[model samples]
Target: MIDKILNTRTILAVDDDPTNIHAVAGYLQPHGAKLLVANSGEKALEVLAQNIPDLIILDINMPGQSGIEVCRKIKQDTRLEQVPVLFLTGSVKDVSEAFAVGGVDYIVKPVRSEELLARVSTHIRLSQLVKSLDKANLLLESVNESLEMKVQERTLELVTVNKNLRIEIDERRRLQDKISYLSNYDFVTRMFNRNSMEQELKVVMETQSDADARSFLYYIDLDQFKIINDTCGHVAGDELLRQIAELLRGGFEFASICARMGGDEFAVLSQSLNLDDAIKRAHLIKDNIENHRFEWNEEVFKHSISMAVVEIDEGIDSVSHLLSIAERTCFESKRKGGGEVSIYNYSKDYIDKTQQQMKIIPLIHQAIEDNQFILYFQHICANNDSKLQKIEVLLRLQDESGKIKPPGHFIPVAERFHLITEIDKWVLKNTFKAISSLPENIIVSINLSGEFIIKSNAVELIRDLLLQHKVQPSRICFEITETSAISNIGATHRFMLELNETGCLFSLDDFGTGTSSYEYLKQLPVDFVKIDGMFVRDIENDEISRKMVESISGIARAKQIKVIAECVESEAALNIINNMGVDYYQGFVAHKPEPLMNLFTLVK
Candidate 1:
């Protein structure tokens, strides 16, 4: 049966003979396929250029371009390669030649309608199947690509989650460790608590016998700690305690046990040491405590540690006795102005000392109220010459008894009562008043406490004072320690710029004494760098100190700032500083701090 073909099938027939072309067209007309005819092979190639056909019918044994030539050309052209070709020929050799040029079939010259229609329909169905298979392959490729992308995204998400989980776990472990440490140790000092100390002490006692020699217990109470805490705030007091703990821990490596007993008290137990050796160790610890300077918020404080050492013997049965002996000795040290070390001797008479000195504090306060606070000026001179370039104003207090007390006597007490700011204000106002009265070119510098700088009104207060006195700001310098300037950089920078804009200069006092001196020097806007007294005092004999001064002096010169060598006590020290290119020197060798009235005579 010949199935009726649709217009979708397009067939092109090429023949040089007009009869052959007409016969093929007439036979395929009932199949409903669109037929295009060309009389020559050249004409067929031209027709192929205009339209793409699904099927081609070629007649061999024609003129010029033969059926084999047209078929070969059609198969070679990639655009026409998909079109199926059938050859119609009278000769068997011609039909074989047609098949060799990619023709699917060849029929005799008298063409049959049923056979032609069947072959054309079969090729059309095969072509449609090939196109459907190509589409399915493309769809599969798109699906594979989408699946790969989703897998990659999920892998990245899992990796990110794993990294976050590991970090969280590490943080949790660190937090747990910190919590355990805090629970078992003192937060301020990182030292064992009283309970830990007691447990260690029992173990120590069990291991020791009479043949092991006697052990000693020393209880340390920070003298004037209450005063420091009250005046400097609890933060400063805590810092002071922490520093003391560190110093004590470092100083006594042979001590069997050590712990912070509570508040400002600490206990140290030493084994296998005689009374003399123990006493010597206590003295060494005392010196380290008294000499060590603690910085709190840029303010430097020297603390006095009072020690009470008790020797434990076979006769002493109780730990409380040792604690009491140490406590009493500490009390005695406190009673005697609290800067010295004392030992507890059980054989000596116990001194029940109380109500012995209640009259001194009031007398001191009254003296300050009565305008008896004395000002002394110490000259800081140029190192290159013996010229007096600057003077450091020192405070002295005269009591009603006509006895003068140094700053060490009442400053701590005053600071405890939050009276230092008032004292500082008075100093500033009077110091400016004093400088206003000085010679035109002479510049006087005053040391400012950290508390003064922290005050919001500090810059304004200084500016107003200078304006009121009509004092040239260049002639008045404010000195701050390196520790102070670096502690609060933002506040310090604003204060420095504001005061510097008004021509008031800043001197970084004790410049090389701090850990952050270099950092502070870079960030602080200052006019002068004061070499600390420790370096200056030893510059004559200490090679390291001399080199440090020279290096710092050179740096200061490079920065276009003046350098002042403080505490120049000897001629040797003076010569060394002068050679180092130091701009100023201050010490007993230059001028001792004298009364303000006396400074006038000296300046002239």
Candidate 2:
């Protein structure tokens, strides 16, 4: 039943018995299903609160809350009511109660593998079909209501068409003309469409006689167009785009062609003599749009645009290639804080940097395979008595030539290829093993990449390593950045919850940098909040930075999360943050990162 079309499914197994959970996982995982397990009904609810598993294999008779009670609670929740629940009960007596409590089906204990999978697949497919039909019914009802209202109007039109031949001919001609117009023009802006613009550009390139003759393709993309569409409605968004289209038409009269490429993107092919002329025209177009404002629902929006000019010369390849360069240039403009113009130069360092980064991807693979990644440790000092409470794990890549490389060079490249998960795992396994020889009081903190938390195997990998190293989970700390948690809150929540079971501490690393929402302290089971170094370093003078530190400390204190200020370079800054309620500090003012062998000196 798990076919190509259905893809992978997620199943949550709730049972106190380890054997039952194992059976459920064995049957499901092989068939491309993700398995989540909880030993109790309350723990199951905690999992369900964040994650919606496709099929739930619930146990009926448990110590505290039975499967029926769990099903009843799940059905009571509006978000989970639609989810199908399957009960695994020992007694036939529990079958009827299971159904009464909203169980889709039931499988008696001593489950046959084939039968369990069959029942699970059947309920999942049926649930999907039911949801699909419900959605289709709503759409079909709306369509039928509109068709019923149009029935009389259509009947009258048919009769009129039979009576009057001239009117019918005129209607047909009007429809044909409209179709012809639409084929070459945009429906929203009434400008040349992408297809027509390609033909026009081809014609221009073929007709050029002089060897020195050149044109510039100005590709423009509206900045923050989604914000306008979201704040205002799509209708208002379209109106603003149409207005921008009009402004472009009026502003760039000398331009050979003005076209609407697609959503929030426009283009103009200019036959200007030099790059300066093209740049000036691009600036004028940008200025014109900036000067104008569109109002909707009493809200005014000043839309800005990012545009790029690519020179079309004899060296240019084709229409597609030219367009690609133009698009890339425009993206660069947007990336540099939009509302600006960029000229594509093959000599620019961005292309070179990209090429260099591409080379590192393989290096990352080799490093992981060969164990070239090395570790360093920095002490997180308890400010009150200048005692080091823990050490933050730092990663470094040793190149083939035997020189140590900082994480800055290779970490970003690793993250770009989604290899940071493996790197984090490497860190955990090695960190746990290394710390095995250290004293238990020396808590070792490992920084987890955003990529690691979202992976399903993160918890399993950590658990196996912890067991292999025979390390106490309480002495191992996993540091997750605020940016990582906010990216996929549900996956992060589940990962943290599962990992928390091992008794490891969590620190919301780089605190003041992300969403800056203090609610994370409550949502995440974080034992510590490590304030971003940028804020901590400037807290001595900057009022806003000081306020941020104070607010974080005040709220985090209320939540009982200890605050650790990073990059505390000055005693003045440390004093300020210490007074502001920061429990721990990490910077040059206290302790610097050193080789793992020197970790013992941190606590000393």
Candidate 3:
């Protein structure tokens, strides 16, 4: 008698031999279980295709396909590999061989009913244990989610109460005829609360009516305030904000209103000022913010500030619109860097262009869904002979109206919205597709934004593209700006090496511009250097500019890397660079970046 009482469990029995299958099925049938039979390995696979069972009883030495082959196939499949396999073999040798192919256990037949039932029951019980573990893991995740939601609810209640207390304090000060001296002002250094400042701006805009009189609103945000907050704690963050507020108020005393807009942001409203005067005040405020040193617990901390100034004119229709324009202008300033100020001018095309871009963002998103963007290749040539060594794939957006818009008009907007990643993916797919049609040994390079490089999965997307296209990785190159490479060295280095491992190359573009370090040139995984257009444009006439290019070209040669002189227009600039041993060149003299169709005609 079997020691264990059999519980009902479904079992799938697979074999080509009908007598052997019947014998195994009959043994399991009496043990309070249902048996499913498949006549061959192919039929067993088909059974699994439709439904999964708790355990499989397989027979070895069947026709059409061996049990070992079926067992191996089952183990190889990710979905079926977890199901326990019990082999039905005629001999001990066959059972040993079956175990080699990932079978769990075996029963030798002409079968003893008791032994077969015992082994089947044990394997089924093991499979049940695994399913139980999975359910427990799911339950643990649900409990964690419930606890997180409760914590978030408590946090919101605290913030709401804090805001109410602040409003009451402001009201009490107003009753005491110390409305401007309210507790909303940080007494330690005299900066207003974010809530108070916003309220003040609303009052000023409502009270003033002269449209021609320019009212300047400056939004100031300190750079890297979080670093000080983390390093020196909330006390230090509070102290820094207080000190910054004092410096701003002192510097802009002539302004109509100076108020702290919470955290590290401050707002200044200057009334009845000309464009030049407003700009002068904006610069002075910026300089003061940069020069001011904050002392926290006896340690001096220095940081920069970014400012966005908007001059209220007749065109400004609403107070919200005025504030929104200032905020967006400030955002643009922050993107460029935090040490300067950007004044919102009504005449600037970027503002209207940005508004139009916002309107088209939804349309652009739809284009991505409908596969409307197309990739075009513009060749980057050898400057000396004008021979094409590589092509740079450029993206063009085709709208519903069948209009092709150049990247220059839309790429900046794409970068601003962080939508460049999707555009980058589309470029990689279409570029690789284009490569298959091009001649072998010709390299294709793609230009990527610093934002895309720093924030997205550029490497993974490119790797998948190369694999799908079956293109040689060596034929692909990625170009990044010199400024971007130096900005985040660690992240850029990791990305470069990851792609380099797959035989792709990297180029440090627009070299000799910005605050790029020459020391970084040797440290970076750079293959080609593209000289900035500024140097090339003036090199023909300016001795100083020509000398700079010569020096940069010499450095590139010493490192055994190629250099491409960009924007070379005149014969003299070309003659100078070729003599300096520049590896390649690009300019109007060689070729301008044209449409891919034009490039085909020009090259032919």
Candidate 4:
């Protein structure tokens, strides 16, 4: 840092004495200082015009101009004012005048080399320090101004970037919130959807045991909903549903989860309520809906709802099972009439009520042990003669109070628990014995469960029974529903083939109700195809139903197989079937189901 400031400095030696100039030049020449010799004041001024030196050594006894005059002239110019001057004097006579004109110090006599170099070096270093300080002050002011400008420009850019960043954060938060709402909430009713409700129930089931407070599920359906939609329009129907959703939301406390289960159906999962309280809540909702009047397009209409409440307890295996009970119970309410509330019952509290599968399992075991099972026979009459063609033996169970329950009441439980095969064995044994003495032309049909057909040694069992009772195999027809047969088609075909070799007949019951579209008939050895009752029951009034029945009958005839129309409850239905070329009919219109013993007397 020091070498840059005080490096290779020049010194001006102004003197009229030639010898003095030579001595001064020779003294500084050996050192690193550049020496300029000026013989007079005028000469020094000429030298100063072309170049500026670091320091000046002026002899007081000069010839042309006095040393003091020369120093004064040098100090007059502003550019040369800061240069340090050292006087070469014969005495201390003119040194004061030299100091007055910016003379820093003076040397006497010939100017010894040691004294001359020391004074020249000191003044050069001092002069350099002053010039560097002045340059720095000027540069500092310029840099400060530039720094202020940069800070202003950069600060503005940062503000803009920060604003945009905040906007992006807010937009992302809004998008995330919208996605969350759509996932968990139904857009139509602004309530929890089925997915959220199922998850909540699953959490409760998985995390808890039998809760001290009983939870209940209410399954609700609007009564005669189609009437409103057809007469008023779907717009009016949607508005009515919205109003009812709000009503349901307000009726229950915040504890319950209310949801719309699509269309005109809704459900509520109560947090905790006993059976009585749950029933009352369901009735309250039913009454509220029944009394609420909806005004649309200046026309006012009233509506009612049917509801079913099932307690959500540990007895239920899963959410689907609990919902199944609720659906059946609600359907039972509609079956009787709308504008009613029904509670799911376990035992004989309901003579023909919705039964829980778990509660009925033990009852089925008990029934099997105590011989509480019975057989009821419904007559299947031939079409052209309208005479008795056969009798279908229906399985029934007697409860503790002797009320007969149909297959719909307990068959699902029996099938699920693998007890259906046992029930089938009982039916086959009793049926074979009851008709042992009957005429050979009287064919008796017995329904077999899919589980029994797929897993049991059915062909050998039936063969043994046929030989034991001496009842002709041709008179005994085994009935398997289309849905059950489709589940195990190969097994069903094998069982039928083995039994067919023995002269026993196979009939596919409930045809046209499964996933198969008449393609399975050619695959199996079926003697008769019973058109599903769903189509036959509505054939008198519905064209679609009539078309379905007609097509099925045509296909059966094409295969050279007879078609049986089930659920022919009215003469209208029978007349329709007769026109369609149906061979036989089985329904209450022909004859109500009679006991197996009673049927024996009729045939005898």
Candidate 5:
């Protein structure tokens, strides 16, 4: 710092007399300024070449090159021109010439010590202030540039947020439309309702005017649906209906129309089928239904369906007539012990739910390959103390058209297809890439899939990733679902132990949702228990949920595990959780999940 301050105001003194230069140097060097002395103007230029002093002192009358000529040369060289020049001479007559040649001030020969020192001090201080002002200007420009960049980033974030909100609103509208549309069909089976089928049949019969215009109708009834429902309850029966609907949807041709006409009864319309094709479809549907097995509650149930086919010729003028004929034919098959596919003269056959779950499967693979996945972070902080802040990483997908999709759309499908492990790895890799830019005091927590933890070499992968990213393991926390961890306790326990050795912390997410949460909490090496939203969201209103949160918080506190309350959407919920000794609160009220690109602004 001394050198810096000293370097800021270096003064070069030039004269033919050593005594004169020595006197000048002696006066200025003691006043916290560096001094350079030259006995001639030629040597002064050499000194100037080596060090561009902030202030230059010149003698007007020199041997080789006069001070006027040297001052002319200094002014000609733009690099040296800015250094303030003070001239020393015997005559006051040279003062106008000195000023003309760019000399800023003059000190006469036989200089007084105080006058020379005072002038030198004045010029050097002014030069230093100018230099400081220039530096300040540059610094201000840099700060403005940084501010512009931050504003642009913030604008982009707001645009992204707005885009996501629009997508969400659009999704809700689409879901509502689907719900309203589904109302015309069976919700459990996702098949057309009896009214929809009858209306569709009416249209077909009325639209096709040819006397021989034909369609095939099939009536389907599950043979053992009642027995299964009675034995396994309605939940299992509903699941059975869904599975059968999928089979029927897949087994028939694309042109065929199928519906769940009523309980345990279904209908299919083949608008362009002859006796042979209709019979062939009936046999196929019959075989597929009998072979399919529905598993529920660890027990497997196999059931067969009876189907009857009726031909819709011009002879069938009414939708009711077609349905009645199909029903009677189906009853004949039911009388044959319910496994046969019966057919009326020139007859049809078949049977179909969550349409979105199927749609998301392809999107999951597309997203992973296209690098559409992105990271979002929600801040978790102490309720009373804002200093204690952390971020929980959340995953989102941006599709080809630039729509941001929340994880809820695709995560279930990914889990179903066992593609969640790959997605988890993608998240971990990207997260490590991002975390190094965060502030040292802010810790980041990433979620680990239970399946990935147990099935993959997750500990080794995470250790390698942390090392590769040059991130401290202590800065990261892994969140695990309580029920998932319990499902594969042995493997999950080992994974936690090995990773915990590397200083990674753990949080049991959705804490109170699982059975035996307290039992498993004792065994798992978790540092936090994130209270489930179900309990926290209504804690202020519902006594049972409030007690559940209290019990979980109490148990967690007893075990030395800090508790975090999630989905804290209101100040009341935050206050309630805070009063219960919960260590942290996270939800929309506190912070929304934002893209990690803005993490620098968030860092402490």
Candidate 6:
């Protein structure tokens, strides 16, 4: 009489008597089912908090908290209520109490094994069927709501038409034409959207002659438009986009095809332009955009665009492939600064970097899942002190072949895909565990991304880790890049201040590479400013580098903030920075990064 439905299901049996619990377990174990036993009603609730079983078998009597009370609590919780409860009552009076407390069915104690198996099987089968139907209903409702919204929009448009016979006839034809126009063009800028552009590209590819030279696809992205959009309203942003669309159409020749792919992005297709001519054309567009200013509410704002140009050759098989290459190259150009251009020529170096960027996403997922990421620490020395008083932690990924990949190779790609948040969490958890085992006074610094800094929950996660690992806040330091701080000043300030209050230190890394005004520098409550490595690398030989170092040091000194010099590769560079009144030195001259475990053996 047993069914296969109960074979794989789990059942939790709760009772005060060991003999009755063993009886239920002995009967259920032979059926190829799992039985979890709880000694009392209180113990049953603890097990239920962590696991939801297909069925709960409860004994009504002989416990401090009765089985009826446990059933009542389970029914009150919507997540646990869907689970069927089967009660075992020794008396007929308790059978009515079981039904009142939301038990699906009851069997009297001194129970027969055959009846126990039959009731458990029936309830488990029904619970699964109900869950399946609930999922189906949710999916159907989503589809219905989407369809209803579309119908309502169409109905509203139909109601606005005139009533005259002649006018109504013309209105229907006009509406059809309007629909066709919208299908191809963006409503706001009146340029071709992504879908329409692909259809046109396909037509051109089919009709073009084989003898003709390759055309060019220019992917243009507006820079700093987000800042303007966020500061001003969306209405102003729309006006700016419309103006840019008109500028693009007017700047290019009539033969060239122009389109707006989406928000703050536009593209142009040019035919028969040589590399030199294309470069000049790209520069012209850049210069025109830089000079133009938009006026809104008596305020003026300027914007620039970054562009990538790729050849539309026979090798490109689809629109997506061409756009992806152009977009990647465009991103590289934008990295240099605003109004920059990059050409995708399939050169070996460009191809290698692009390929690495493409592969990094999946590799990051694998690294995190397999726990293959590791930490290395580099020593930093304070002024005139040769000891390794502080160390900065660095992260590296290990491949399956046991080769370690540097952060430079993967960090940029990880940042682009928003995977940095997960990577940072992994680093914080592991690093805190490592730091806890080191000397109580040893300081370790970890880098955090801007995206993580902006999250409201990031501080809570860090605080919990610190408490769990038993690491002192003063022994840890957080390093953030200068540009990241300036990008979201309010959030960055709050993140730094909150942690600083807990005795954790903050450092402004890559200083002097961002804006030179130095006003925001005072607002950020950081303990140290690490001079950018580019300037520190040749401080002894280069006069400009020395002056830049001196100027940055003097400002930090004025604010009572310590300064750390990076890239101190040689004795001359180290001597120069030391004389410049820098408080700390970090580079090969001090000590290179090594695995935390290899550096020393600590009590774990």
As a whole number from 0 to 100, the lDDT of residue 537 in candidate 1 is: 92
Query: Poorest 10 consecutive residues of model 2 by lDDT?
Result: 160-169
State the lDDT of candidate 1 residue by residue for 1-604, as single tens digits. 3344435578898876566777788877666778899988889999999998878888875555778888899999989886778887764434334644677656666666655665567666656555554465565456556545755778767666556556655655565566556445776788886556656665655665766467777778887676676567656777788888888888877545778865577888776458888878888888888888877667777778777877766554555444545666776777678775666674235433211222344544455456778888887776454443667789998876788889987776555433466678778888888778788777788888776787677888899999988898888788988877777778878888999988888999898988867767888899999898998898778899988898888888888989988888999888888777787878898677779878778768
Per-candidate RMSD vs. true structure? 42.0, 17.4, 23.3, 45.9, 37.0, 20.8
Estimate the TM-score of every prediction: 0.42, 0.50, 0.52, 0.43, 0.45, 0.55
Local lDDT at 59 for model 6: 87
Candidates, ranked, TM-score: 6, 3, 2, 5, 4, 1
**Tens-digit lDDT string for candidate 4 (176-235):** 576567557766688886667778778767776565777778888898776776677556
Instruction: Please state the error at residue 24 of candidate 2 in Å.
Output: 21
Predicted structure 3: lDDT? 0.72
TM-score of decoy 5: 0.45
Model 1: number of backbone collisions: 5
Cα lDDT tens digits, model 5, 348-453, are 2221012346467667767776778989999888756565458999999987789999988888877854568879988999999888877767789899888789
Error of 4 at 229 (Å): 53
lDDT of each: 0.73, 0.79, 0.72, 0.78, 0.78, 0.80
Instruction: Return the clash pairs for model 1, or none.
Output: 231-416, 380-585, 381-584, 381-585, 382-583
Q: Cα RMSD for candidate 1?
A: 42.0
Q: What stretches of model 6 exceed 4 Å from their correct place?
A: 1-192, 212-260, 264-310, 328-356, 381-389, 415-419, 481-490, 510-524, 528-590, 599-604
